[model samples]
Target: MNAKTRRLVAASLVAVTATAVLAGCGSADRGGSGAQGGVLKLWTHNAGNAAEYDVVEKVVNDFNASQTTYKVEIEAFPQGAYNDAVVASSSSKKLPCILDVDGPNVPNWAWGGYLAPLELKGGEVPLDDQLPSTVGKYRDEVYAFGFYDVALTMFARKSVLDEHGIRVPTPDRPWTRAEFSAALADLKAGGKFEYPLEMGTGGSGEWWPYAYSPQLQSFGGDLVDRSSYKTAEGALNGPTARDWAKWFRSLVTDGYMAQKSGSSPNDDFLNGKSAIEWDGSWDAAKNVEKLGDDLLILPPVDFGQGPKIGGASWQWAMSSNCAQPEGARAFLEFTRKTAYFLEFAKATGTIPATDAAAAKIPGYEPGGRYEPLVRAARDFAVVRPVTPAYPYIASVFEKTAKDIVAGADPDAALDEAVKQIDANLKLNDFYAD
Candidate 1:
């Protein structure tokens, strides 16, 4: 089944299960005395990620030890289930004092009255020093900030590219649309691998928008127009968007990539089953382990608007219902230290949030092995739209894109997507105040 069907099924299951689970939870009393020498509850979507959880625990421990006024108590949830849990919590008015939010969800949560504005004092972490994509802003106010962000790029082995006579692309001089297409065609003509590229079509959920929307943007199309933050109309279904759709579907039709690639594209690339893999920085360590000096981390193709990649990862935020905003803000400020950012990036193998933090990380600094990722995040990253309707917009795009790939007419699919997105925006009154 396609991703849209899977998502619908998952949503049905979550809806059926959430009611029973949330029934016993107590409502969050927003009127209580603010963290009066008491524990401030925190939530994280790192239940199974030991390395990341370990760093989080260390930060919490340090924060508690350094303060006598309030202590932090944390609850961990698996990433897949965390959003459902948060939604249930919000419905029951039982959100924690502080929580880690996925970047795109910030606007949704904040708009739903679940997240409060994160007020960081001046000189906290030099927000300007961080990549633009790492800061989550809604309605012109900062709602969340992440410790690290990931960049998307094409992964290949130098030997394979050299053997195929394909020109390696760099951040400064990435392959244009025609050049990229020709390269892929040449690589496929060799017929050594099943396909020349693995676009990670097998992955679902946010991966669809995170990986593919940038390509759309590069084609002068967008999920929605940022000018008004109100509609997907011409931006999504325009002539340029149709061009992006046709080119995207052609990747499969021309046999340059699989309609449904292997379960693990990175592994396929490492195992020599594919020549190039479009993926994120999270796979860098494992790819390096397998390919060693043969690894070639190439930039995303410049479709038209000069190469673009989706940005923003997990970010920390304060709950709007938290009575202890001061305590929550204190923890946020405490964790903003460059040292902690370095630690998190090291533990998570993600690009650090700030230049200072990046400088501290070994492979992310200037001339380091993974500096290409840093440059990509710095030069090409574009955060998903900051509107509250992003969730609906993303779903619409995913379904439309999947249909377009599955032989549905691009114009019709995009028109339907734009209609749905516009309807959603209207239902929420454009999420106006």
Candidate 2:
């Protein structure tokens, strides 16, 4: 966290009286020696494991070593602080040359004039192959470039499932809500697992939305009505959404998922305390590394209607205040065009954003534990809302899902979510009705 960011967040904390904590959000301005030759400063919020950092460092180092025209210096920061830091740095005229912004922040930053349009004359970032949903539009103009691909998938311990006599769902097959309920009940009856499901609670703001997003889709509900950009008047709280909330709530009320635990949901599954872990494709890599070939990945659960698969594309963007914008664009283009993205995919244990990278990287093998995850990622991937106010909108759904799981009344929860979202939409100047 930098001084400017701390000051801004402190002021916002006092004013809003809301949990908009973006503390420790900015990188400690690091740069390469001899800016006389034009150095490109890069700041990234993706703080993967230590090994992942090493891979990124190596890539940056390789880039610096390969070229002498301009040195690229990379700085890291926590994801929580990224947007705040970027916003603060831009205000202070200390923004980095290359900025890696997330999906929701991309549009907001671009629209706010804090980021330079990648299509500018000197902007040479190739976004032709990127996902249209992630970085395609920004106030009717495109500014960011999507790089990495992340999709949701179901993860479970194969040993626990087999011990409980639970048949694993097929790679291409999705289980209806009834079949899914029975599996959890069977696991509970056999006493093989204390909880059949465990959703991570690292931060309710981020994890909770994902837990219910897939179900929302199956129920024929969406977070934001693409056409209207409002949930209260939209289908987000429709029958499909109601069913999802009720069913998910039952998992906690009926003692299927951890309700009051502070530890990670994945930790519970790894300890054999839970039968399944619904996580993103990123988890496939961690589980494979943690449990080796013993883990089983399954397609997301179907609501009898069908499962809703969601995914997002990661992007790398150059800031408007960057001194060496051309150099930063070169680096961005390199990461996307070269084998760097493929290396990133393999190292980070995620699917590549580009079709070319997907073809080059090692894929899940047949009969493997992750085959189902790979299949699910491919067949049913849905990206989140790409609107400028997406994070705020996602919060509406997250809070509602959390309340429902905690045994709150379904109708009351939906009604409250609708009310709160309407208030926020109005405050944020977005349309709610």
Best by lDDT: 1
lDDT of 1 at 34: 39
191-250: candidate 1 lDDT, tens digit per residue:
897688899998887899999999999999999988998899999999889999999999
Candidate 2 segments exceeding 4 Å error = 1-37, 46-49, 65-68, 120-142, 157-167, 201-203, 289-294, 363-371, 431-433
Query: To one decimal, what is the Cα RMSD in angstroms of model 1 from the true structure?
Result: 4.7
Q: In model 1, what is the error at residue 131, expressed in angstroms? A: 1.6
- Cα deviation at 230, candidate 2, in Å, is 4.1
